[model samples]
Each structure stands twice: as structure tokens, then as C-alpha cells.
Target: MHNIVLFGPPGAGKGTQSQKLIAQYNLVHLSTGDLLRAQITEGTALGLKAKKLMDEGLLVPDEVVIGMIGSALSANQQAAGFIFDGFPRTTAQAESLDRLLAEHHTKVACMIALEVGEEELVKRLLERGKTSGRPDDQDETKIRRRVTVYNTETAQVAGYYAAQHKFHALNGIGNIDDIFAQICLLIDQHKPAVDEAPAAATREVKA
Candidate 1:
């Protein structure tokens, strides 16, 4: 499977890029925000609990987030792969995900970290707010807080995966298509080699 994580801070265009990746690669997109939103729309218990935290601008707890992700994975095991847009924001969440995927015999093939300057991110976020009217982008304070929280919480997970040799940093400043091309290139370069021992053995059999 080609499971991967699209990692980045808020306003890093992760959502936009993930959509492109899903369309181009035919991978399942597992976005934590979408998962929670679905639960909230369906009035699931976990959705109600997460809604409380989100209403207060507080992050949903790790256990709650993990549960949402687990449910998504179980449902998508037959998919070609998954592109995790906004999950595993903490070390604990990362560890839980590792264990969960291990149980399913799937590992993350890569983590593409969309790198952008804070000033640029803030600018884009403010512009998005003007156009999108998202509550989180309504005020500078909330936008800044979201970025701060992302850095404090999610940045470490980048390092954690980097140490595992699965992290690839992609420049996120450019046209949407341009940025996506960078990500595709990185994935191409980092993709693990296919098992060739069997091919070699087949050649020996032919000989």
C-alpha cells in the first residue's frame, strides 16, 4: 500500500494539496477534520465530545482523535492507499497510528512536510478567511493561535518521522499545481524499491 501523511502547519495548503493527490493517485483521503465533521453531522458520541473542544478552540484529545482515525482505517483497508491530511498531531497520536497500522500490516510510505514561512502562511490564512469565512480565520488572534498551536504540537511529529527516514520537506510557496509537482517528485524519489529477489530467482530458473 502507498499510505502516506501530508504534514504541515495550519494554512500550509495541506487540504488543497491532499485533494489533488487523491485525484491524481487514486488514494483514500483520511482527514481528521473531515472525520470529526462527519461524526458531528451524524451526531455520533465522539462528535459531540469533539465539538465541545472545537467550540472552545481547544484541540480534541488524543484518544478521541485516535478513535476517529481508527474507524476510518478499518473502513478503508481495501483502498489503494491513504493520504492522511491532518492526523497524528502529537507524539502519542503518532505512536498510536504506528501501532494501528502495524496491526494491519501497513506502514506509512512517506511523510511530505509542506514547508512555508510563517508570514506567508498568515497572509494566506487571512486571505482565505476573507473568501472562505471560516470561523477559525475570522480574527487574527485565532489564526495566530492556530498556527502557534500547530507549531508547538505538530512540529515535533515531523521530526519523529524524519528520524525514521520517511519525511520529505516540500516547498509550499507557489501555484497549487507547482507545489503539488514538488510533492510528487519527492514521493517518486523516496518510494521504496520493489522486492527484486524473486525476479532474480526467476532469471536463474530460466537459465
Candidate 2:
């Protein structure tokens, strides 16, 4: 089972890219925000707890996030793979993901980090505020806080994965298709070689 992570700052188009990647690669797209919102909307037990924390402006606990992801993964075992959009932000969550995927006999194949300038991120987020209707997104102060938290808390995981040779950074300023193409190239490079093609080519050349 192939597993991938798309890491980027807010407004870097991670969600946009993830949707394209899922369609092109047949991978399941797992967005933590979507999952949590669904849980809350459904009034699940975890959702109730998460809603309380969110209502109070507190981050949801890691265990709750992990449980949600674990449930998603198990239910989608028949998927081609999974593309995690915003789940494993902290190192603890990252490690937990590693363990959970291992238990399922799968592993993270790549972590695609979309690099964008902070100024641009702030600009995009502010514009997003006008349309998102999310209280956190609508508040500039809260948006900045999320960015700061991501830099301090989540950015470190990029280096952690890089040390393990699983990190790939892509410039995120171009057109949506351009960024998606870059990611597609990386995934192609990581895919195992097809033996059938090599064998056929060898025979044709011999003839």
C-alpha cells in the first residue's frame, strides 16, 4: 500500500493539488480538516470532543486525530493508496502514523512539501478569509497564529523526513497544473520499475 503526505503552509494549494493527485493516481485523499468537520457535523463522540476544543480555541488532542485517521485508513483498505493532506503536523503524530501504517504492512512512500513565501501565504489566506466563512480563517490574528504554529511545530517534520530521504520539495508559485506535474514526476521516479517493459525491449533489441 502506498502512502504519501502533502505538506505546505496555509493557502499553498495543498488541497487543490491533493484532489488532482488523487484523480491522476487513484489514491485516496485524506484531509484532516474535512474529516474533523465531518465528525463534528455527524455528532460523533470524537466530534463532540473536538468541537468542544475547537469552540474554546484549543487544538484537538493528537489521540483524537489519530483515532479519526485510523478509522479512515481501516475503512479504505481497498484503496490504491492514501494521500494525507494535513493530518500529521507534529512529530508525535508523524511517528504515530508510521506505527499505524506499519501495523497495516504499509509505509510512507514520499512527503511532498510545497514551498511558498510567507508573504504570499499571508496574502492568500487573507483573501481566503473573505470566502471561507471559517472563523479561524476570517480572523487575521488567528490566521497568523496558525502560520506561526505551523512553522514552529510542523515545519520541523520536513527536516525529519528529509533525513530519512523521503522528503521532496516543490515550488508552489506556478499554475496548479504545473505544481501537480512536478509532484507527478516525483511519484513516477519513486515507482518501482516495470519488468515487462524492460524484458520486451531487450528481446526486440536482440532480434
* C-alpha-based local distance difference test score of model 1: 0.76
Question: Residue-wise lDDT of candidate 1 within 30-119, one digit each (tens)?
Answer: 777778888888778888999988999997888887777777767665666677877787777888889888877777888888888888
On a 0 to 100 scale, what is the lDDT of residue 31 in model 1? 75
lDDT by residue for model 2 (113-171), tens: 88888778888988888898877877778877877877776577887788878889889
Whole-model Cα lDDT per candidate?
A: 0.76, 0.77
TM-scores of the candidates are 0.81, 0.81
* Alpha carbon deviation, residue 120, candidate 1 (Å): 1.5
lDDT of 1 at 43: 78
Clashing pairs in 1: none
